[model samples]
Target: MNVLRAAIEVARFLEEQEVRYFMIGGLALQHWGEPRLTRDVDVTVLVDPEDLESFVDRVLERFSPRIADTKPFALRHRVLLIATDQGVPVDISLGIPGYEEEAFARAVWVKFPAGEKLRLVSPEDLIIHKCVAGRPRDAEDVESILIRQRLRVDLDTIRQWLEAFRPIIDTHDPLAFFEQALTRARRSLETGGDL
Candidate 1:
């Protein structure tokens, strides 16, 4: 089967098992407004020890997940990488201590393949996440989404989030930086650059 179908099957399994997950990453941005191609599907789920064990069990049974225990010594949790039959990776985060609530609350539902419905992190949340993550790829992804979607993302909402999660961004003028990014994205769109 194709990657999309694989992801849908996984989502279906998750739903059937009553496990909650918030879809994040490139696919989610594409759904919002930006169009981009990404190989894997990334999901952030609320996971405790019991939830993690149950999820791992279900995923292994359903998809034959090949797990990698890659947690740091200081971290209390770990990430489970479940590779699909099509070789698409699904990164299931087992409980991020700080941002669990916001991640769940900001999820916006979108239609999946085969007429299935699933929740994805909002564009604003995606922006916040990428910025906080501070990875080069994340910046590029954010730029692509911002330009293509012309999201009209609520500046205040993003600003508030940054203010609340200041440590993550590691910058004092997050609002200004966010506005600058938005402006650059709009300019790129106006100039007909991959919008």
Candidate 2:
């Protein structure tokens, strides 16, 4: 099955099991503009230990983890990564102090196949999270989304979030980096080049 269909099925499964989740990662850009193909699905949720255990169990029941990793190298948070059989990945992050409420508050409803509804983090939120993560791939993903969905993005929101996290990203200068990457992406797109 195609990844979107698999994503919808995962959302349906979460709903049936009463597992709350928000659509995160690159796929979320589609809500604001044209769809982009991502290798896997990324869902973030406020999962308590008990809830996480249950949620992970439910996911594993349907999509077995083909690959699992718990690397020693840590970034902002320690994460358990699981690659499922359906070409959908599930990254379960333990709660951080402030991100839960912010994510829920910022999330907007997105309708997928057959009018199925799921909450997705705003583009601004997605970009901010990726920027904060500071992984090369995350940065690239942010740039690609920004370029492809520039019209749909709320620049003010991105600016605000960037300002709020200025202290953390000061060294990386994510805002400046974002703008530069955006320029490059737009040029590439115009030239029919890949991001």
Candidate 3:
């Protein structure tokens, strides 16, 4: 299945319901960084913590859950895993206020060559998201973004968010990953994008 088409459908559904959301994960990476293959759709949806059940129920009307106990699982994990009618898997992150609110405000609508406007997380926000993910692939994405963006990204903002997330996610040092990626990205530029 086409990830963009499925993401577009899901995004449209969210818009119809007036639910605030933005495309994240690999798809957003493709817009800001290096193009890569990502099978599933990942989005951050702002839902009232008190209204999760109804929100999930509302989503169920348009999409089917990939898991058995989607509502309970989403409530516990803050992520709703489901699939579109065309069978493209999607992970809907239950976002709260504060940082997420800011990210939403910074989100941009990128008009593809075919005239499809896909809402994507900003480059700085995308870097933050990848840093939080902390996988090797995520590191590569960060590097590509840094190399492609150079001084365009808000490194200070990224650093600030990483510092705040530092205490919460002790298993992963988001700041360190960003720093390392920044270094490598610079080196790659120095070496003519060989890294």
Model number with the top TM-score: 3
TM-score of each model, paired residue for residue? 0.77, 0.67, 0.95
The residue-by-residue lDDT of candidate 1 on 1-195, one tens digit each, is 355665676677778888777788766877865567777887777756555665666666666455444333113446667777777777766656556677677788888756877778888888887766756666677777687667577667777877777754554445555666777787887887774
Pick by lDDT: which candidate is best? Answer: 3
Model 1 off-target regions past 4 Å?
48-50, 67-77, 168-177, 189-194
All candidates' lDDT scores? 0.69, 0.65, 0.89
Candidate 2: which stretches are off by over 4 Å?
A: 68-80, 83-87, 93-97, 134-156, 169-171, 179-195
Instruction: Kindly list the per-residue Cα lDDT of model 3 for residues 67-115, writing each as its tens digit.
Output: 9988899988989999999999999999989999999999999887667
Using TM-score, rank the candidates from best to worst: 3, 1, 2
RMSD of each: 3.5, 4.8, 1.4
| lDDT for residue 142 in candidate 3, whole number 0-100 | 93
